[model samples]
Target: MMTQNLLVELLVEELPPKSLKQLGQSFAQLLAASLEAQGLMNQNAVVTAFATPRRLAVHIGNVAAQAADKAITQKLMPVKVGLDAQRQATPPLLKKLASLGADASVVPQLKRELDGKTETLFWDSIATGTSLTDGLQKALQETITQLPISKVMTYQLADGWQSVNFVRPVHALVALHGADIVPINILGLQAGRETQGHRFAAKVNPIALHNADSYAQQLSTEGAVIASFAERRAEITRQLTSAASQEQLTLIDDDALLDEVTALVEHPNVLIGKFDAAFLQVPQECLILTMKANQKYFPLLDAQGKLANKFLLVSNIRPIDPAQVIAGNERVVRSRLADAKFFFDQDRKKTLASRVPELDKVVYHNKLGSQGLRMHYVRAIAKMIGEQLGGDALANQAYEAATLAKADLLTDMVGEFPELQGIMGRYYAQHEGLDDDIALAIEDHYKPRFAGDELPCKPIGVCVALADKLATLVDMFNIGEFPTGDKDPFALRRHALGIIRILLEKKLPLKLDELIQQAIKIINDDAILQQWENSSNSSEGIAVRRMALTLTNHAYIAEEVPVLHKKLQEFIYERLAGSLREQGYTAQEVDAVLGLDPPLPLILKDILKRLVAVRAFAILPEAISLAAANKRVGNILKKAKTEGFDNLSLEELSLHLRSDPQEPAEQKLYNALIDISDITNTALSTDDYVTFLQAQAALKLPIDDFFDYVMVNVEDKVLRNRRLTLLANLHSLMNRIADLSKLAT
Candidate 1:
């Protein structure tokens, strides 16, 4: 076996900028994986992926020219089936051997082996390895077939009658092993040593690569291209930073835009461009979005974090005089900014309150009615939450904010850029001279849009945010739109997580179950259902009428709402558990804390405290023994209940016990429980979970001794029930903070 570095490249028309990064990565990964699976490449081989606007290429080190030959043993038919009574070949066995490229002369050499209860014949042979030429052909075909191409283009090749489908039109293919060109063909292109680079700035029209190792250097020097995506992005970052620093401005940090820009250019030249300062009169968010989304330009911010007049553009070409390029980009951006300013000016002509009627025409969901109906549900939910949190004053403010929240969906600015829905609402509300709290709530209601995003900054905002997210979650789940596996089309998981983050992070006293019930009640109200039926007779209204009928039918609502509530509760807790584990808590610790009975407090804020207490208790010297004892107690109580002791009460525990201990171990356990009962109660009263759990250490010794000496299932009925009552009290005390038995390994 001989080894050599290999290079593979596919030259095509300009690729999609947003998908180029993934395309490049997948191409290289799939190729290398296929080769390794065939034993033509080592697992530790170094692989480098190269992606530019016009090419996808890869270089792999230490790839064998041919895979190693392997020895194989394959089971043939049973001996009786393969051989006649005289031990001669039968027609079926001869045909089977012929299919394997063997003949009857070798039948005598076959070995006999027992397979299951029957004797079987086995064939041993050496399999030849696959040559690089054939292996690379298969790898290339598999890679192309498996590329993550969302959409494919069907184009005819140079041959008039033949057509091929690919992400882009393929122009050339190059495959090399060291200095030799490996023969391969794909997409109507043959492997070669030539590839075009840079499109216009190349020193050579088609640069000829010398070898697998020289491909990158040759392309960089002669083709005027940076072949590596990461290296190209780094260069762009360096240039942008240097240019921004020269003018004492900061560049807006967006990795997605940076990657897209990197994929759009081969030779990145960061040029500073400027627009009229008057354009900055628009909100910085609006201006920044236009620049980045419309023109793919990086906007710079001044010292106060305000948008500056200058922006940085990544150009594909560098000229001796960069003034013209700068001016050209500035002209394009100025046009985009003027359109944004025009939309802003037009939208401010009417207040957000006036835009409320327009949302009726916008369908939120077919089954949920229009945005107008959803607005009512959210308003009702928000008012209830506000009343619970801050009484009448906050309730009025939240109602007002929730009313105006979706009003922005009709504004010209938001219609043009849907990302600015809540954002534009805040601005319009402020322009109308509304209360600062109400205006802030309009925008912050959509806060924490993604993971690690900031929550609402004010109490009013928190109330409305929770209301909006809850409304969506309950309605979607009601319509059977909950997420299944990785398919969360409605983002229900995100909505649940957002609600959890606000409640826990803000330490709001609101209960999770209560919020869900409030949402369900508001959406299912008769008045709300009547409004849906009377609103209109359009298809949306028809759908809403069906839904309203389902909600108003007392039998259906009674049966479904509780089930819906339990589902929503479980959904939230699941999200919370995953989030806790991600925060570094072990699964056992999370399980122990969350496994309490439903009647117990499931307050989101207290969950973290309980988890912290569990973590601390898990490290104590007596923690393991206590956990095991708790588990044993739980099992014994469960068994007793199933044995017709379900009504055993702790109030009658003393009644069943003798004046003195019937068994020494039982008395010791009884005394231990008495000693810690008051201590645990006092600790629990003050929310001292750590103290409550730690106090259990005193009972571990007596518990172990009792289990060892006392028979819980004794023949005497009175003694058995007495022991059951004692264990029930212990189980109740041990699980007050968490189900410690879950911590038992």
Candidate 2:
């Protein structure tokens, strides 16, 4: 057998748990490549790995003893002493070969020109074998430099040496070929028969590993340590499940939490720990978060499906008294619960809505403004959305929700734990007995904190959510927070995505500029709010109502409104286009359809359904001929001077169609024009955009013939004008489906 029983190990400082598995995998690859490079592997070999947070080790068995001798072909000049010009081995070639081992008697040299190069060649097998010692040395040296390092470090392995780079400071290494230690330096430690067991478990001076299998057994016998993560995990689960069964309680499934638990110990021993049942008075989420997030304990669910007030703690070491270990863990969990209760109770002191004014002191962003300012922005846009939806019931609820939506930010509970922003708002609103719609909207404003979560459900909630997100987007835009590629540091993309979901799902009737102006007015505290205060008294409710109304109104109602209103429309259009494409429309179709009406959903819905459906009926000769007519007229107009297109005159239709009924061009043009009114009416009645496209297609053949049969450019001004007028009428009718000529197939 080749010195096959080989064990190799890489010992290092603690490795990141997530990175350890892959690192272990790479070590085996490096070793395999070295073996393959030196041609050392054979059929009987096997390689395996054992990893821990602290070290990665590899073992190979039944390895080859020595490399197989390699065979190579050589081409040498042919020797000729008594050969004819026929090109065969001569007596001189035979004499030279006989000198080696009488092989000349059987061997022959031949001459032939190959690939434009003439050569005489003699074949011989050259066997080169490698010694076990030489091959092992070279393989070890080659692997050292190529080893993957976590961060890259230097550690010396030579006797009385200084430093060299390594993944970590290696405490020791072990490598063996049967009874003898294989000498190789890795991370400042020479490989040998000795390897340590679990650090804390077998902190003995040094442990001797007699052979391959003894490495694991000898260490365990020496100390209560199990280093294999998989084995440790299985043992922990078995114990925890068994313990929970004994108590008639079920354990919650938490794979992610268990992974963290696995990384913490070399030898895992699951122990049941308990705390006062009264502490369960806190909400279950807080209790679980406290145990798992703070204490790393698995919670037990009771027979009634409520939290059992019990926890499972996986320990690295067996304590002298198991009860003492349980007690210590309970104490820590209790302290966390106490803190949670304190914060929860303190939050109940003041109503969340009443605390809104306090947000003025809180900074949202250094450049973006304060939390109070953000509230004004979100509220203004919310009210605007309410008006857009045009329902007094929903609009009223939305107005109230917007004013109180961000009130939780000022609450002590939220301040203590910012993650509880919406949760605290829900709790505080319920405590104050606010309208359920208002309370729900207040809590659900931030419904989708991430993509693919959930959007607000109720109309009031949806409107306010849209308003809040819009205000944030506009403020960021005003401050120049445009996103590029993958880097939306402020999450502008997320805000845009939320806006799209709100519009698409709620299908709200909204004008993008009206919404943006509301957003801008919310943030325009200096411009609009300054004017409102000058003309109105804050104490008078009547003046407040009037000022609120005046704030959202625009002078021209379109042109004189805020610039961000237009910017918002542009943004909404892009987002709408992208969203519709995701819903399975071509990009150009979305642009063409969305372009016909304002994005105010009511207007879009009013016009888009008919327009879209009309396109479907437009497919026959009507649509084809119309598309053709528009294409012809467009091509002619395009080729003509870049000046204005001549306006159509019915006098030309009078001259051509009526004067000469036999004229093919004029006859075809008259028929196509006759269908325009009926075609548009049929498409509109069907409510199918496809019908409209089909109708346009019907016109294609006649339109093509009209342009082909007649000379549109004539020496006489009257005839040319008449043909051009007929073409213009065709373009006007065909454009309803789409600017057919602008479409590129």
Candidate 3:
């Protein structure tokens, strides 16, 4: 079989910077997949994708000029309907054969087979393979139709009135099978061997590709363009590093920025530019964000990672003098920085406390009230959480912090850059001469903003952060604004995960249920006022709505409070389980540890400690047997309840054990549990769960003997209840740290 490398390209106007990389890769993969499906390429074929600001191309190796012919089986009419009584060709068989380009002479060669009690006539034939031209054409069409384009542009074709939609206006399409043009058309452009190069830097206007193998080289050498997106990005990185090294600074590394820059230029010329030192007075985060987000420039940092006055920008043109490009970019960036500094200076004149009232005008949600009302809830919850964790001092600090957390939403700086919301609050709070804890808390309340992000560093911040997230969950859930499927309009899932992360990672002495209750109380306290203000425009209408909402919420709170709390708790635990599994805990292990019933769920403060213990316990030599025994014990207890032993409470069963005679095996098991109870209880009290599980491991022999020699479902009522109680006691002791039954395979 003969094979040749294939190349295809589509020249167009500038593509979307963010989607360019994905588009280029998808094009190549889809084309190659279509070819393989048609038997034109093999598994060993390699695909190379090329994407630039003005073009998308691909080079595939080991693609055949034509696919191999395929053998196909065709079913004709049934035997009785196709043949006459004398077994001669009938009119139906003759007509079918004629339609297949065969005549009556070939009807005798047809094979007969039984298909579901019906004798069917079948024919075997070879279908001609598809040529490269046709296969490439189909593949190209499929690739375009399936391209993951978030948006498309419509432009008139050469016919003027005829318009087509594409990611960008298409200029040229090139398709080559080895040296021959595999003729095709896409986006109203006919395939050809000629494609234009860099607008200003190419040596030639139209660089004619000689073969599919030489597309990249020809473009780079003659056209002065980096044809491959990866190669172009690498060149930009190298240039940035070299330029930054010459200035004794480091370029901030952001992969997303790198990709966007790569898609914005066919040829990159990294240049260092400078802004006035006065702009550095603004916070580095503000300056850095403006440069990266507004100007698409990379800010340089000093040895200690402090933002330097100088920045780097990539230009598409490489002029001989290059001074004009460098100066032009520096001027544009200076203007952006000045605006940022202006916002910073103007925002500082008004203290965060004064801005608090302005948040009342800014609606946080249509159903929920404004940011002002939400802050009230946050303040209440934060103070309560602080008091629970510490005392009145911490409570006061947390209250103060929560009071001004959203004040920056009204600040000019944060208004211009919403990403700087909490950050600007911290800066403004410090400028207002607030305490360090309160200032940090204002900003740190939004910490762990993303996955793997750090949580608040101080206790004040932790209290406010937890309260803010809890308020969001409780309020949103109260109004029936829960997340459905992947659509979480309020980011309720993120708030839940944030809550779990703080509780588990910070080792906070907080109960999940207690926190939910605190948030619920705050939510209920302000429900009428908030709902009324949001529901109506006039004071009289507001009063009417307020009363209605109060009456409705009274009923809602009574019925849905426990239900929503459980759901939210389950949501948080699910997110935690996913996070833990991603961090390397097995699903079974996570389930086992989370399956433990909490007395106050404040015990969840020790969840991490228990998880570590569970992992260690799982590695014990007797772990499998113990886990199986626990599962068997659970089944026996479940069966006992079904058999009229309805009162399965540990307390009730313990009372029955007082008068009930225990079997010999049960007595021994009881003795073993009693022996380890003291040590296990001491270890648990000291948060030494690993030691507790290890102590419980000593009961393996007695538990195994109890299961082996004892019949838990004996005929006598008293005997069964006593054995059930013994198993319950054993179950409770073994699972003091985790649910061992969940660990059973």
Best by lDDT: 1
Query: What is the full ranking by lDDT, best candidate first?
Result: 1, 3, 2
lDDT for 122 in candidate 2 is 49
Cα lDDT tens digits for candidate 2, 195-274: 66666666563677787656556656774555555666677889889999988999999977776677667677899888
Candidate 3 local lDDT, residue 225: 92
Q: Per-residue lDDT of 1-745 in model 3, one digit per residue for the tens?
A: 7999999999988899999999999988999999988889997899999999898899999889899999988898999999999988889888898888878776767899998899999988888899888999999999998999988788899999889988888989999989989877878888999999899889997999999999999999999999899999999999999999999999888999999999999989998889988888899999999999998999999999999999999999989998999898888888898899999999999999988876666666655656676787788889999999889999999999999999999888988999998999989888888998899999999977987789999999999999999988877776667788989988888888888888888888788877886677667664645554664343343344235435546313566667767876777778878888987988888888887765336445677787899999999998888899988888887787677663456556556656664556666787788788889989978989898888877888988888788887788876776677777778778877788888888
Q: C-alpha displacement of 701 in model 3, angstroms?
A: 3.1
Worst 10 residues of 1 by lDDT: 547-556
In model 2, the number of clashes is: 58
Which regions of candidate 2 fall more than 4 Å away from where they truly are?
1-12, 15-52, 56-259, 265-277, 298-324, 511-514, 531-642, 647-687, 690-745
Q: Can you tell me which runs of candidate 1 are displaced by over 4 Å? A: 531-545, 548-556, 646-652, 655-660
- Per-candidate Cα RMSD to the true structure, in Å, reads 2.1, 10.7, 3.3
Candidate 1 per-residue lDDT, tens place, 1-745, comes to 7899999999999999999999999999999999999999999999999999999999999999999999989888999999999999999999999999998998988999999999999999888899999999999999999999999999999978899999999999999999999999999999999999787899997988999999999999999999999999999999999999999999889999999999999999999999999998999899999999999999999999999999999999999999999988889998999999999999999988887877777888766678887888899999999999999999999998999999989888987899998898888888889998898999999989999999999999999999999988888877777798899988889999999999999999888988898788888776765665576444465466456548544312657788888888899889999999999999999899888864464788998999989988898899999999888888877777777874457556655555646888998887899899899989989999999999988988898999889988989787887888788888898898889988999
Off-target runs (Cα >4 Å) in candidate 3 are 74-123, 526-556, 597-602, 643-663
